[model samples]
Target: MSFALKYRPSNFKDLLGQEVLVRVLHNAFNLKKIPESILLTGTSGVGKTTAARIISMCLNCTFGPTSDPCNTCQNCTSIKNFNHPDVIEIDAASNTSIEDVKVILENSRYMPISSKFKVYIIDEVHMLSNSAFNALLKVLEEPAPYVKFILATTEVKKIPVTIISRCQRFDFRRIPTDKLVNHLKVIAKKENVSFDEESIKLIAYNADGSIRNALSLLEQAAIYSNKTLSEKITKEMLGYVSRYTLLEIIEPLVIGNTVEAINKFEEACNSYNPIIILDNMLQIIYEICYFSITKKDPSIFNDNIITHVKNEKILSPTFLSRIWQVLFKGIQEVKSSSCIKQTANMLIIRLCYLSSLPSPKQIIDKIQGNTKTDNNRKALLELLKSNNMQDLYNQIYESDLEVTNYNNGTLNIKTNQVLPKDFHRNLLNFFYNLTNKTWNISIDQNFDISKSSNSCYNKSLDPTVCNILQEFDGAKVINIENIKKEQ
Candidate 1:
């Protein structure tokens, strides 16, 4: 019993985070502007109940608001034990009917039996139904001078605006990582518990903005490991997959290995939660982006992982963002899927194929370097006549589409930029034979270039291929003309 409640923060000064709220509340009390009712809104375990108790102690104590309560006084002792005659802690969830509320109200009119003010705390007040809320609204709207109401709720949305408006609301934010870690360290020392900083951070991350949740997870982890906390122990306790496995999954997607990537994902299915896998990928991408943009180590995030885990920071921000887009879509797909593994595998395949894609710069640069000149055009015309489809595909894929006119056994090639010799040969062969004409490839900044033949070509190659060729060349297609005079 002592262990369960031992670490509860005893006063506002003891509370970590929420400095503004604490300071405001203190000022309100000091100035005697304490409202007749107050709403404490936030997620559970961040000291709402404890704060309520502390306030009760402060208001009724013989010597008060000096950082320490006179716990020996009758009012302080009763409130401490939560059995004060003047202070009532009601579980609004369990007794939410109009009759229960009416009974409390009847008692409210009479005033405090012993303390300065009659205080009523309704926990999970949002759980009260509409009828119950209506019944309680009368007392909430207008209260006696000596009566005070305190309402706490996790789901503030469920509480009607009418109820919210009547109370002075204070929102408790999630405790920060450093604050929580230090608090945990202090508690552990007093309790003779053993743990490391990394293990504590893992617990904090799992808590997800709830200090109470953090403490609860710490208690559970500590018990499992006999008060000794380590990364391995915490991972096992929480059923979390290691960073290495996540990196392995990312490696295949980055390098364009669809089969191997999907296989690795299958191998880790039992060991990993798909949602968590997606979350890890997001964290990894953020780390990479941070490293790329800021030249900082992603490992020092200080919230989750501690030591720099890997050097996957080599990935660029744009690439990381693209990968994240694929992953974000994949996670959404897997969530509604009846067969999660199959959906995840399909998504992994899609992710791998993304790496094979060329950026706009690459395509534009290739086209610039591989324009067909007089010598190149003649060489390419020879390849065209010889009928080399493979060479044709390679050259077309590699080059920008500038050569617009192909007619009657001669290749007219045009470009303001020079073309690659190999590219010239490949395109010359493919176009001349396919059109039954010598290819005419021309280059001129003034001439409107033809639409990307490779882009149009790839539409037939990969189903997911989307041609964004216009972005690279800073030009648009005027026309595509292929003419063969009667041969």
Candidate 2:
């Protein structure tokens, strides 16, 4: 199979994304307005190297600046083969010291050996240290007429503003999924490979907008399927779980079913790898929030689940937003934790508890429904008015009881999820005594001590585990014996 680099487009016409940049470069080259120093900023595998080569070819083409590189010419062929004496490619990552910069500078004063203009292409320019940048500044500021410099880096911010001000900067964005997928389709067809639409989509999405990555993944999928391609093969090759599994785990969280939530998580963990499971869950939550706000079918979320989420209001723009806040923090936690499964399970349980907790809107609705006096409700009203709902929710979620929605009909309240039932009753009664009327009260579900069952907690069953599983009251492993009969 042709890997990404093997089918690498050599000309600007073959470039997938960054049309504006290409147009600008093409116009510049046509106008004979090539800059002495050019800076290309973008992520890796997004054709930075390819673009640099094309620019070099354009400048050195025997047909002239306004003409295309006639691939037949010695200059064009040598540049394409990366053996042109005038076209120098350096890895700044390995040669990042100031001495290396001086060596490059020592040669910058000389004219091209055989081509029209000598080109210096420095990949990963950000790897150059401060001294290295300073060493190269003078030569860049006043370059020889026969010299061209193309600096490419994934990070542009690290390059000193001094160096930045001296170059024509081209910001290459990540290749969009659609464009990448289209390119992938062309490659697949050319390679005599067959793949489903979903397979292409997954590869494109997983590539994260890098053409090189998309090609690499396609290659991996092809190998996994024994030189064939399909949606199932690609998914299995990547070990990526279905969106359904993420949705199933999330449903229990929406309804505050701790046991079922953990159980569903454990069941998914069995077949799918733990990291993949967490990533899929995190992605779904992100999509749920994004789609909820944009109100568009992105084709990633299942249609039926979207319908259900739309109907139940569980996935409201606001609620989904809050869920995202919780999940984002949880994702980081799971990623950093030594025990992946245990950390992820804890995150799931925490999400379920958070879902059961009163939403910001619920708090506002309760405050509005209770207190009669406008002046008394103003304090709680102001709290809601501020968009600091996340902060308040967390404060209320973690604090102790004695929270009163109204004291002497004044809406002064505190909240806690861990308050004892009797203490909670007394706290509510205290508020009622002050108001001389019933006040709305609520208590969220506590973290279930009896329901704790994470793989990390039960490490006797596995040796590679790091954390202790949540200690459940009565949990057992049932290993079924094989039935051997005379057969």
Candidate 3:
């Protein structure tokens, strides 16, 4: 038997992860208040079907209707093998017609042949057609007391809400990596498979919380490595980048060496996935930031890499954020690009060059600091473009909009250009969601830019000019300069 089937949870007590589901079902069955219908939803291999089988065992155990069913009982054994006559299991993906549902409903009306309750376990219930759902809905609405339905699906959203409303729902959680690691350890010990801790962890990480996938990967690893699993063999089998190679690639990335980074990345590329390379880079960024904030090094990384991190001091939140955003974007590019190597190399070059570029705040500050040019408009334009609002960027840039004041989440602007309908409302909404703060944005048609600090009309600090402007009404200061020193 495969490891997945051999190690599958037989009872709620053995089920890993999903404490809430087990607790609720245990209480329900113990209280003799088991719902006539149940809906189990989660990603595959998180034990939705296993839970359904356990529920069957709970209902059919010869002792009584109990949460803890005896595995030795005939009914429990039959349900474990999915051959129980009273507990019928069908994959709705294959049998998804109204006629099929009608037959099941017809059978549901009859008393159990050998058990107290007749159970119908439908897997992938979302695949049922509208007509089939309608037919099943009518029966589920008024189920017979002797009948129980256990519906399992990965895509609960695809199922009708009405159907969901009729059943007790349990959303299963993915097994955490630590839990998966421990489970794999137990399985390996049982099979007498020699393995290392890192190898098991690599399997669990690659499994992405799917217990079945982890077991399958472990089983394959054991066979391919001659019943002995090492980190090297696991990396080769799973097409994962090695710890050494991961650090080697990240060193160049951190130091902003475009050529070396791309060279290291291409050299490491073999049967492994390019996406995993990006994921490794992201992991490095995460570790670096974690170290910078906590002053403690992660054990997974060697001292060599830690020395590299401290020497470069590249783990500042600003620089790390820059690398993180680019690599996160590169993962998708490699996934969609026709040539993974080319796209990845290009991404590496971008990352190396991107580190030297000024951040958005620095760029805005530099623009605003320039006294000769009218920079307020350019600063606002930069903000729009940086946020990827191309439409707003174009409108403001092309129309020659004048921004007079910007401070304390209030944007004061002077513009005569025609804007699209609901422009202010949409802009406010976007800024609010982005900043999580209410913003005051007002456009003026006839504002005096001459008195503003960020405006192009240069204002003076001369006492006479300041007094004249303050005393007079609607007075403008036009390019006052060469004032006396404060000494």
Judging by TM-score against the true structure, name the best candidate.
2
Per-residue alpha-carbon lDDT of model 3 for 182-249, expressed as tens digits?
99999999999999988898899878889999999999999999989998898889877665677787
Model 3 scores a C-alpha lDDT of 0.82
Give TM per candidate. Answer: 0.67, 0.74, 0.70
Q: Write the per-residue lDDT of candidate 2 for residues 1-487, one digit (tens) a residue.
A: 3587689877788887989778988889888788999999999899999889988888888886643566678888898888999999999999999999999999988888897899999999999999999998999989999999999999999999999999999988899888888998988888778888888888999998899999999888877787678777888888888777778888888778899989999999999877778777777777666666787766542344465453255677777777778888888887889998888888888888887678788998878765443443454445434535443333333343233444543334443232333544554565466457876655443334344344212323232221222354444543323356987
| Local lDDT at 380 for model 2 | 42
Q: List the residue pairs that clash in candidate 2.
A: 403-414, 404-413, 456-468, 456-469, 457-468, 457-469
Q: How much lDDT does each candidate structure score?
A: 0.72, 0.76, 0.82
Superposition error at 184 for model 2 (Å): 1.2
| Candidate 2: 10-residue stretch with minimal lDDT | 455-464
Candidate ordering by lDDT (highest first):
3, 2, 1
CA shift of 43, model 3, Å: 1.9
Candidate 3 deviant stretches above 4 angstroms: 254-256, 290-307, 310-313, 318-322, 363-487
Candidate 1 regions exceeding 4 Å error are: 2-4, 64-68, 95-100, 298-314, 322-343, 346-487
Deviation in angstroms for 457 in model 1? 18
Taking the tens digit of each residue's C-alpha lDDT, what string does model 1 give over 1-487? 4433766666678777878768987787778787788899888877788877777777777675434566788888788777899889999889988888888889999968887888888999999888888878889888998888889889999999998999989898887777777777777777678887788888877777677788788888889999888877988898877766777777777888788778877778877777777677677767766777886765533533323344353266777788888788788988989988778778888888888887667888767655533345545545544665654544443443343443465545444322344555655566655777665654343332243343333232222232444344654433444566997
